[model samples]
Target: MIKFNMAPTARKLVNEVMAVKPGERALIVTDSGRSPTITEALAQAVAGAGAELAIVHMSPRLMGGIDPPPHVSAAIHASDVVFLQLSYATFHTDTIRGALAGGTRTLEMWGFEEEMMVVGGANVDHAEMESISLKLTERLTRAKRGRMTTPEGSDISFSLDGREGFALLQTAHGPGEHCACPGGEATICPVRGSASGVLVSPFCIEHKDLGQISAPMRIEVKAGLAVSASGSPEGERFWAILDEAGELAKNVAEFAFGTNGACRKRVTVREAKKAMGTCHMAFGDSQSLAGEVNTPLHVDMIYDRPTVWLDDEMVMKDGNILI
Candidate 1:
């Protein structure tokens, strides 16, 4: 038997970060594809915190937004805190929505592995991460338009008009407030049909797969739709995934700047997406980000060494955040 050690980060997650008090029902929602060791660690933490722990296991979903078993949904709504430790996310499902409606705080740890619990962004100072994310949100909210460029030939522009960006903090302290653990970022939804230009990806996170861009892969967006992808064999895979998602797949769904100071590159997408100085471009599902575009999929393509400008003001230059 492999004995997986629980790191202090796991302890912080249950005790200080989430504040799972005694008597609170902390529910773990998982699937067969997920790591049992990670699950046990979380369960141990919940137990140590004096919170009643109940686990609901289900089969993995083929795609995001697909509903979990009815019993699992029921458990979520009844619990005080819900932890999603699944291979594929059910975040967009009505099941989770209902739980949030009923005021159950959630932490979506989609695609999280046992190793992640032991190290990486999971160990960061979450309050400081939140503080950074909040500051980025303020700046992003203040900007009406933004442009991103890279030396590798990525140049994209989009309108931030009337859009509000938000921080994904590790702590969820209030009703109706949920977060993703190992979280640190400010994300926004661009106005519909407002994005255009070429996006050169440095790395990508597709469903359960994370890959480095070995060759130049550029997605061409015109009026917020990715009409074509070019420059590498990976482009074919990207186009196919988008095409498989149906017409809504073309829509430029989200834009975000990573704010987790402790995160590094080439790790899980959840951690990489929050690596300070990097940014990700997501396609499909804008509803969660307060935009109109809605789709079953939300795929993020991360880029390294980005130089971003918000209406003539440079905010990020070469993978470094500037105010």
Candidate 2:
């Protein structure tokens, strides 16, 4: 495999985004299935910053939201900063919650490819993205209801009442704060049993069988649960995962829009979900983001150019931020 120079970005993460202080403990976590290039670069950056660094490797998890090994969890809790470079996301697991609650700043970098360290969303102006994300987050926090529609015939509405919006600014500057690398979304969890409508998406992120969706998938949601999914074989595969995971897996868990200007179209799902003007909805395991639901699964479906409304105000129209 070709080696990409990840040193620059890794240093940025350690020094700028994470702001590792001298003598602070920093941990880099990865799994067997993931490449170690990024992890090594991160370790070097941490050590170069005068921080005590630890690197751990384990077997890959079956899916997102699964917990790490006990020792790894312990290490995470002890660290001042952690970079999760696992094959699958552990963002929703109790381990992460425990780490965050203990004042460990974490950065989720699951499913990240080597090329991502050099280009794409990693090149985004984080400060500008943070500003945009915060603005949109504030709007979502104040709105009682939200509606999303796409040209592909999606129309979903949900109650945002009492929901707090989150901004993924790609930084973990303070204790107890966690963010995703290449993150630039303004997201919120809808009330349980409050989402109802059809959701159409061109593609979904990370599945056992379907990678990039072969065809547009239409999901029917009623009372916050995905009642049915169709329109492609990929849809059937998606429904199967949810059906097998049990009832809680079908909950309409998240509503979010991309904010990173550096993201390109038709890239990896990890980057695509952060592409400006795009939007996505997720199913299952939202407690990490302060939602009521919890499940072993967390999957996102992405669609392009959506018109979004908060309460009676149009916040985004045809992928443009109207404010």
Candidate 3:
């Protein structure tokens, strides 16, 4: 049970973050792992917004990538908008893909803690955050090539020719929309077989609960695939997860930077991954982002203080967005 007064925040999420307009059908999807306190609050807010609200709680998925039950999928298709406040996200599932294809917008609020729903990055000025993300996306979208390096031993180069950048701007003003509430990232998919070099992960997202890097990890990339990884038990786990997912899991999926100025360190990587001045690389599942790779697992590795260059122009230096 959450100890805080999350009603106001939940109302904000329903009214502002989700932009629930009058007479819209708003659906709340939850798993057994979620908190009822927050869920009920959201229900209240949706009713307050004059939208028909339905709450569905299902058994948690056995794995991350599996689809929800058929009834849940039906509810998703019937709704005008969906709010996923589940412990395990429904974003990557075919159910969500099908719903989006049918013009239903969604907000992926996965693994959000009690406090996060009320404060920190989750309570940011979303319009400003979206503006920042949009500006960076424009810059990344115009670039044909990119290079990134860090003082802690990271040097990677990749091509972005004919690829556009994406942003999770935290608003669903259009059809087939999907955004995370604490979202502010600008990401791009590297051209297949065009990425090569070494990435020294000083901090891994899987190891975030430790709150600091224990043993640094090294990921070696060749032809857009992570060929090998070394250092730390976390590093071993990272490799093992991808290895179990098969060949496509090794593909370099995304290169992105955080833009949420209000985010900070927490118990999980959820908020940290959105913190300003950090960058992350994801492997597996890039088909949605316009890359050729497709895998059930999509994992992200985070590191600090990156220097990024789009072709010859420096876009970010030492974790700071320069232009």
Candidate 4:
């Protein structure tokens, strides 16, 4: 059992960070690897929101593996919205991407830790888990394309397509509604483009230095897949660790946006990824929605800001969400 001393603060983190609204029944996904203090406080906020909350706990042992708890599949579909805060589960990229695209919205919260007498019971990366939904779906309705700048002055585009793209891919894709995982397009998924969906941050992970990067990370993707991955020794080291995962290495695991205004990558993935004004990418099964995930291996890369062009329109420039 895990426990923590409660900190007094506003209960609705959903509202403060992502603006979760009423009439939204949120599925609160966490794990034994998550911080008990955060969970306890978040639960109270959900209730205060006048919204419904459902909690899904991923098996602790499986945190580093490819498989996910079966319950997530049903809960994602049943809920009006979802809230995720687990690092490992975020690799389920398919679930986060497909769920939001398919009409299930979510609030992205990652890299949160306990303040004020917090005890570690589990690792819940809410930013890694739910933030993708906001990043991917924000443009879906109008779906424009735009360029954003990276800290290194690199440019990238990010955005979604009009309603048509979502419909075609969901219908024609092999998994169809099931593209979130391996069973079908529903179970596992691949990148299907319309207006240049999916965006990644530029942070590098290297051997024994996941905390800091000696080399800069450059990443590019189209639709929903990563097309190119680059970094210095830091980049190679990151992939080197990821390569050990076998089939999981084949996957371009994560696609994330930053929220932590105070964070910047150094040694720990949490701090680097949670650093404000950035985002990260992963290549693997996407426990958030199992993808190339067969083994449990997944990796994340963070970059400062890259120009984003979604559907030939500009949305993010210089590491900023234009929406």
TM-score of each: 0.92, 0.95, 0.91, 0.49
Whole-model lDDT values for every prediction: 0.81, 0.88, 0.80, 0.46
lDDT of 3 at 186: 91
Q: How many collisions per candidate?
A: 0, 0, 0, 92
Better of 1 and 2 by lDDT: 2
Identify the runs in model 4 with alpha carbons over 4 angstroms from their true place.
1-10, 16-24, 60-67, 89-92, 116-241, 244-260, 264-268, 274-298, 303-323
Tens digits of per-residue lDDT for model 1, 117-225: 7778878887788888999899889889989898778899999988998888888777766888778889888888999999876666645543666677878999999
Which residue ranges in model 3 land beyond 4 Å of their true spot? 1-4, 59-66, 69-71, 206-213
Q: How should the candidates be ordered by lDDT, best one leading?
A: 2, 1, 3, 4
- Flag the better candidate by TM-score, 1 or 2: 2
Q: Which stretches of candidate 2 lie over 4 Å from their true place?
A: 1-4
Write model 4 residue lDDT over 131-184, tens digit each, in one string: 433444445334443344555645444332222111111011111122110000
Worst 10 residues of 1 by lDDT: 1-10
lDDT by residue (tens digit), candidate 3, 41-109? 888889999998899998876334456899999999999989888765566567888898899999887
Q: For candidate 3, what is the lDDT? A: 0.80
Considering only N, C-alpha and C atoms within 3 Å, which residue pairs clash in candidate 3? none
Residue 226 in candidate 4 has what lDDT? 47
Q: What is the lDDT of candidate 2?
A: 0.88
